[model samples]
Target: MEVELKLLLSPADNDKLLQHPLIAAHARAPVRTQQLSARYFDTPDLHLLRHGAGLRVRKIDGTWMQTMKAGGSVQSGLHRRNEWEGPVDRPWPRLGKLRKLIGDQQQWLDVLAADDLKARLEPLFVVAVERHTWDLDVDGNHIELVLDHGHIERHGRHVPINEVELELKDGDPASLFAFALRLQEQVPLRLSNTNKAERGYMLCRQTGTVPCRAQGLQLAPDATAADARLAILNNCLQHIQRNETAVIEGDDAETLHQMRVGVRRLRSALKLFEAAAPCPPALLEDIVWLGTELGAARDWDVLLASTLAHIQATPGGRSGVLDLQALALKAAHAKRSEAAQALLSQRYTRLLLTMGCWMQQPAPEGLEEPAQDFANRIMKRLHKKLLKRAQRMDESEPASIHRTRIAAKRARYALEFFHSLYGGKALRTYLKTLSSTQEQLGSHNDLVVADRLLRELNQQHDAAAATIQFARGYLQALQTSRTPDLGAIRAALHALRLP
Candidate 1:
């Protein structure tokens, strides 16, 4: 297994990193440089990619080496993957050698033998890099820091590479993050989940930004609460980091929304597992801070894209809707830009590093209890709390209803995190009902938020005051027209059985 953390850097930052005092002070040996050229291979249909594998043959210092990397998980730039490598005599991939490494792993054997796989394999793209490596022993932990500079080329097109990788040679994973965070103070570094082969594949296929989706969780039946909690957190971080590029560079609203969702899920997980695996109050506060930053931009996006559009299509709604939308959208776009910039900020980077380091440490005491037992206790309490809140939905004020929505959301997230343990047709039915009620409550809450934002817009911009006023009135009427069926929602909540 190969354990490493990959950080993206600009050309200037790369230079600054080399001269950084920490690198100079901690160097265990003189820096060594190597010129590496690797050619990735896959079937025309991307069979290996489909199986979560990558194959490449590289020439380094007049020797050929073939490497295969199998399934792995990446969280907050740290990659843990199964890798096999051996010297090769030819440039083409030696599938036989890779197959031998599989060593009677039935699944891999099947994949390797599928439909004349060897004959179908072809070179995809070439990655050439001048790598400068530094071996360091920081407080007894051995680490290898490498700076890779070059380009990935395919069909005469190329993309520059300026990345730093911190591979753990022999040490606790926490040390790697600590070192990376120290370097981040001197150089602008972005946590990157993309590997060289993935980049090469993207270039080969001319692929565009791919929005990330919530990953499914798979937990063993006898797993402990700590095991499940760590898995959930890892998945959340991966979703957030995987979509970072799309959120920042592709300007995709969905990607940004998914990233925000990831943060929310993490916060929810922290709360859900509090009894078993308590999180630091400071860490919780930091996560909430990040979520707020993401929410500000996403709230505006929902208002402009969905709420405003709906109003503009209604009767007497088009008169001033576009003007109001234009003004609000201008401000919303500014907020989104600010949010994007925050993702690249050192503060945010530190949060990721801190979270990664925390995850590597041991879980709190009670979390060693069986996962099902812990989940049952937690879910029952959440469901009861949600039911109590649901009872007052009709008579409660808007603030109360909003609180109900949040309760429902938390309960829903808890159910999702533990769904695999109690999965059944009944559980699915309960989830569907919960989802419906949650959506209605959420829509109501959105309207409440939108009203406040429109009022703020009216107060902030004198020129758009009249249009904003019109919007507020329209929004009020819309909110008045769509009364939530609280009775139905309450009944659904009552019907839910603890899974």
Candidate 2:
């Protein structure tokens, strides 16, 4: 297995990194440059790629090498995967020998060993670059900092590749992220989840982005809090990064919403695992910043779409609703752009790197207990706290209701993290009701925000006053009509049962 962290930056910023003092400060050897070119191969239908594998033959230093990579997890910019590399007589894969490199990976071996697949394999894309590398040891951890400026060209479409790979040859995995965070202060780097092979395929196929949701964390039965914390946090990072491209390139409202969910999930995980999983205060503050940024866009989107539709349905309300809708959509678009740029900014990248580095910390003392036990204690306390908060819910006191809603949300997130560990009909029933209560609270909150937003617009732009007045009246009516049933929610809370 190989561990490495890859970062992307602009070609202009490339020189900024070349002169960064860290390079010379820790260099174990003089910087070396090489001209390299690699040709990726895939069957006509992309058999290997579809089966979670990639084959490439590269020429560097007048030597040819064949490599195969598959089955890896990418968390926040860090890559850990199995890699097999060896000399090849020419720039062509020698399947007979290379297939053996992926030993015990029977499924992958079978795909490569097929004679028909080999016959159909052909160069699909070419990646050519000028690579500069320095060998450095930070705290005794050996790292190869590689800077590649190149492009991947296929069928006349070229995708630029100006990136750095911090390949860890010998060191603790956390050290890699530690070095990355330090280097980030000097260079504006974006943590990349896509590998070169995958990038080539995307460029060649022009594959579109799709929204990503959190995947299941099937923790082992014997896993401890230490193991579970890392797994849960890694899942959150993947969820956030996966939706990143979708939110940027696609306008599907749901796509950006999912990305926001990813952010909230991470914050929730850190709180639930508390002692076992800790993050720097600065990082936590940045996460709160990110959530607010994403929330602004989401709010506008919902107001323009969901909320406006409801206003239109209100039996008898009128006055420039259409005009207000137009303005809301424009604001939503602007907010959406701002949100996308945040994802592309250096500050956002730094947030991920800092969090990733912090995540690598060793398990704190006293967290060595089994995950099941840890989860039981945390959930019990959380459930009790939520019940106490629920008992305070009051229609007259919207503040109290919001507090209860927040408690419900936190409790729900905690339950979700441990759902797989203790699955049963009882757990399902509780979670379903809890979700219902949280959503109900959210609907109430939305009306309150809508009213405030419309009033603000009315104060800012005189031309919008008439329409805003009508909108505010309609919003107030909606709020009055749906008085949140605190009794029902309290009933659900009192019946709380932990799985």
Question: TM-score for all predictions?
Answer: 0.96, 0.95
lDDT, candidate 2, equals 0.86
Model 1 lowest lDDT segment of ten: 392-401
**Predicted structure with the largest lDDT when compared to the true one:** 2
Off by over 4 Å in 2: 113-115, 314-319
Task: Give one digit per residue, the lDDT tens place, for model 1 in 1-499.
Answer: 8999988888977779988889988899999999999999999999999998999999988989999988877865689998888888999988888888878777777778889898999998999999999999898999999999999999999999999999998989889889988998889887778889999888988888778988888888999988988888888888788778887777678988999999988988888877656777777777888888889988898898888887788786657677888887897888789888988887788788888888888777878889898889888888889999888776348877877888888888888888888977877886787788778988888888898888878788898778777787878887888879888888878977765
lDDT at 289 for candidate 1? 83
Model 1 lDDT on a 0 to 1 scale: 0.85
Displacement of residue 397 (Cα, Å) in model 1 is 1.5
